[model samples]
Target chain A: MENVLNWITANQQIIYIVVLMIFVGIEVIGRVPSVLHTPLMSGANAIHGVVIIGAIIVMGKAETDNYLALVLGFLAVILGTLNVVGGFVVTDRMLEMFKKKK
Target chain B: MELNLLTLCYLIASITFILGLKMLSNPATARKGNLVAAAGMTIAIAGTIFLYEQDGEKLHNYAWIFGGLAIGGIIGTLAARKVKMTAMPEMVSLFNGMGGACAALISLVEFNHLSKQLAANEVEISAVQPTVLIIVLGLLIGSVSFAGSMVAWGKLNGRVKDFSFTGQNILNLLILLVAIVAGVILVLNPGQPLLLYAILGLALIYGVMFVMPIGGADMPVVISLLNSFTGVAAACGGFLYDNKVMLTGGILVGAAGTLLTILMCKAMNRSLQNVLIGSFGGHKTAAVAGGKQQGAYKEISLSDAAMVMSYANKVMVVPGYGLAVAQAQHVCHELEKILEEKGVEVKYAIHPVAGRMPGHMNVLLAEADVSYDKLMEMEHANDEFKTCDVVLILGANDVVNPAAKNDPASPIYGMPILEVELAKTVIVNKRSMKPGYAGIENDLFFQPKTSMLFGDAKKVLQDLCAEVKTV
Candidate 1:
């Protein structure tokens, strides 16, 4: 555990960039025109569902006897999974209808 | 095979997420954009499970992992397939809340593990300040998002009414201060599990209280704000674990969610602070409803409206939440086609906040197979309305209300609205003279040139289509 912390401290600069990169990324994408903003918002809602990975990682490392950690970790995975799957699927359903004029 | 490869995979996934978001700017590529991001998430998750190792131990809890995934995936699939278009906002809120709860739980679980280490003297608490900071952030923000989103879902679902009393804002502030103080204490004393639990409880309560007073009308902005909260919380989890993909995904979601919330606030002419603290949806404004029409409103028959629509060189159809309530979008599309068949050009004028959420009307219209090109945003649509021969407003009220444009005393004053009044002839199709969702009378309904066609939007448009065919 201490080793991971040391590694993180060493790579702090990279982590900050990764975090800041999202803002730069959106600025480059520009304002999502109002017509597609709902889908965009919902789609972005699903993208954050990737936090389930954190849940999985934490659960894997938890001591087998630590039931509290295990339960919280398991529930986190469940909820996160729901967010990712439901969010993307619904966003897709809405976006597919946006067809150009025939 | 190495840690470097794992980081590389995460970087690739993050890039895909950004690419997907960029593609979402246009309607034509939004679906494929979602798919691309989904693919990136899949890779990020898969790579972490397979390649990530710590202290020579690899993750082996397959049963718990697969069980959670399978159940969650099934529920998500069913919900996505069955939810109505009008209920999309609530669904998004529900899912966003789930994601937030997940982040909070992760922070809780990690904090517990860390506390155990501290108690065992396996590690010094002082050495983990950075991790502690991230954990508290995730715990605080995630709790707020989770609880706040649940309230938003209730309001959107009509299960929860806006609750307000005197000094509510002060109470909310007090609770927030208590949570922040608890968070600070937890940072200083990292081994205290009870303090962590207290912060969690207080933050959750604050979340509920913060949103309970906000009216249903402010939900789009609240939902957007909560969505951003979940993103930042998720990013904290990423920072805690040093997972590049999680960090990148969290940042993207965070930035985009903030942008969305600001856009919603701008559309409504409300500041974010007002949406958060003003209780704009409370009972203060409830008494203003149930008043009689102040001026005379003229009602038009189906034939007259159809005649006006059919002979017009250019017609603009303005739809609102009432259109969705009547399930009239498809029928309205039929009216547009019939008018087009009569050599009248048809266009849809969409307000920024039209329907239940931003871009909601476009989704409804798209479901009816309305061509994307026919959907004009508020700015362009307002410009076109001046040259339009007729404006056919389908159950629309506040968006086309003259109050938004000319009345300084109106509650919706200073808000940008569609300029349907500028058209040569204005025809509003409504069930009756009742006010719109905003609970305000539309002055446009009483204009000399404005004639109201009273009926359910679906039935009225159907009758209008029939009349147009014969006219």
Candidate 2:
């Protein structure tokens, strides 16, 4: 565990760069087949649950000087999570309109 | 105490964003998406404040940040609560504009910080190079989004000239020139406050100008496209602050917006170029030929029309924009109640794009608490209309246009329509014989099986409902 921590400490910046870059790559290439854009967009909107994750991380790891940041970040994430959950449910109901009859 | 709780929160917030996005496909689940996404955003914002330490110099006007968020949140909530559903497209434009403006403002504040440090000869300020890039990009896109959104709002509200102003486009061009000239000044001296304000100001003007010429019928497309721009601007702000959440949120909006724009094009049966250059749908030359004497159908009094419908075995109601204009949803509901009581089977036939905007009729019907089962989509209701004893049209046209049947030259050609004419007896209520948005007369009004009852839609419908009860 100690050795792993040391290696991670040394490579933190690179790791940040790599993860951020992958997200960017997804953004640039995230084309839903022309047929699936509406569905895909709705699907992707559901994934916005990450905002909640972001808020939690900020609040839980807050320092003494970052009290306000912690509160604001948590608030933003909670609101963002509600949006994701509601949006996904709505999207599924919408997609049902397109289902084929057996 | 030194836990990686912030990182975990960020991961959760990101997942919420994804979930919201997935749920946004259907209107029914859209609320859940919003709730979840809002929860995620709250979490992300809180995390930023709590988890992130201030290793660098803190911002001086953090209070202003909180103030802006509060004010924006209040205004957004008020608009959502107060605005009519019909006006939702315009309201969306207003919200999107606000988002862009916020991004631009935040970038400006950051830029100011960077320049102040540079002027003080602080060696640490050298690290602000990426901040400079983000600032410029944010200003450009945000200004456009803000201005464009306002113009779109105006167009949807049908006050084009008020938003466009006299010679607005020309003035916008001049502003762009000034901004370009200011850009050179900015490049020559990166710390010029005057230049910063100038370029940002010009960019804002350019946004309005770009959106001004667009017409009302294309508002959905315009708003969706601008939504994409707002997203990009937000992402740019994310880049400025090195915030992962902002980047992700911005990218998602941008991608979603582009996709929406494409869908809007399909709705209009045109390309993006056509939408931009084709003027709007409301005032095109009449798509169907008129002025030739349409055969006159028999006119019916309220009493006679009521008698015909009261005893009908099956009655189908085809609603159009006129029903909306007349605010007759309540009356229609009343009429339905009366008819159903008489053992008459009643159903509402709706077109895909019936009203000015998509699903306009559906929302109006939903508001009246009309039973979902009673409301039938066009395809489902078409064949049923043929066997019906009477088909009552309450202030509707265009969708009943026979132009789709025989004339391929019609603008609405190839679009599917409800065959109200298929009914054994048809009653059409309109104030005048004037044509619809396409400026084409309704041939269904003149057919043998159809009867025209000219009057106010709501009042006439009420009269019919009362008369149907007595009959």
Candidate 3:
């Protein structure tokens, strides 16, 4: 944990650029008209489901005998997975309705 | 070597996500965009499970990981497939809540482990200040988003009613203060397990209180705000681990949610502070204060409505949450088609704050396979109303209420609405004379040019369609 802190602090500039890049990237993607707001909200909701990776990384470093960590990590994985799957599926369902019929 | 590979995989996945989000901005490619993002998520998940390594050791517990993934996948797929279009908002809230719970649980487990390490005389707890800040922020924001989303879900699906008492706002503020104090103490002394629990408990309660007083009218903004909270909390998880993919994904969602929230507020003409205070939209019984009885409303039979529409040169259909409740979008679309066949030009009038959320009406109408060009936004729709021959409002109320434009005392005043009264003639389909979710009587209902067709929207639309064939 200490070593990673030192590394992140050292690379703080990179983190700043990445975060700024994303914020600007979203702004540049242009205006999502009001018609697509719901799907956009749902799709963005799915993107945060990436938190599952954080759960795995945390649990991977824990001791094998740590039952508490295992249970919490497992549930986190399940919940995060649900968010990713359901969020994307529902968003696709909504977006499909807007697709131009070929 | 394994860590470097994992980083590369995450990088590629993040790029795909960016592309997916970009694609989502346009209607033509939105579905394909969702698929692209889903593929990226799949790669990120698989890489983390199979390739991630730390301290020169690969991850174990494949059984637990895969088992959880399979179960969650099935549940999510079924829920998404089975949810009716009308309930999409609540479904989104539920799924988003789960993400928040995951972020909160991650912080909880990590904090527990860190405290244990401190007690074992291992690493200095003070040395991990950034980690502590991330854990505290994640714990607080994640739990708030989770609990608050549950309350929002309940409110949206009609299982929960807004609850408020005198001094509730003060109580909410106090809870926030206590939670912040607890977070500070926990950050200063990371070994105190009790302080962490206190922060979590306070935040959970605050989430509920924060959303308890907001009424249905403001739910779109509330939902958007909570979605942003989940995003920021997820980013905290990313910061804790220094994972670039996680950070990028979190930032993307966080930024998108924030933008959505701002847009929602703008659509409603309400400030963010007014929304967070949770004071608007709860008054349902305020009397019409002008002390004069409004004109009696007139009712039009289904046949008359059909005749009027058949003879009109142009018809604009205005839909609201009532249309959604009756599941009438399909029938409404059928009516549109039938009217179009009669040489009556048909268009839809959509309010920015129509239905339950922004773009909610578009989703409903699109599900009924209504063409994208026919669905007009509030600004565009308002402009066309003066030229429209007949404005047919189906199961909508406040969005057409002239009160929003003329009556400053009305709760929804200053909000943009469809100028339905501008049309030459107006026909509204509703079950009764009851007020809408805002509980304000619509002045448009009593206008000389406006006549109501009383019944369920679907049934009324069906009867009107049959009568139109006769006409």
- Which regions in candidate 2 have their CA more than 4 angstroms from the true location? A1-102, B1-4, B54-71, B121-130, B158-189, B279-299
Per-residue lDDT of candidate 3, residues B94-186 (tens digit): 998999999999999988888887889788866776688889999999999999999999999999998888799898999999999888887
Can you tell me which runs of candidate 3 are displaced by over 4 Å?
A1-11, A14-22, B282-292
- What tens digits encode model 1's per-residue C-alpha lDDT throughout B1-471? 667778887888988888888888776688899999999888888887788888878886767888888889999999998998888899999999999999999998888888878888999877876688789999999999999999999998899998878899999999999989988888888877888889899989999998998878678888988988898898898888877777778888888888778877887887888777773434444454334347898988888888888889999999988898898889988988888888999999989888778888988988888998899988999889889999988877888877877767566778899998889999988888877766777778888999988889898888888999999
* DockQ category of candidate 2: incorrect
Q: What lDDT tens digits, residue by residue, belong to model 1 across residues A1-102?
A: 997898779988866776577666558446677767778888889989989899889877777888887888888888999999999999998887776758
Docking outcome class, model 3? medium
Clashes of 3: 0
Q: Each predicted model: what fraction of the native A–B Cα contacts (within 8 Å) does it retain?
A: 0.77, 0.03, 0.67
What TM-score against the true fold does each predicted structure earn? 0.92, 0.75, 0.94
TM-score of chain B as predicted in candidate 1: 0.92
Candidate 1's C-alpha runs over 4 A off are A1-11, B279-293, B466-471
Among all candidates shown, the one with the greatest DockQ: 1
User: What are the clashing pairs of model 3?
Assistant: none
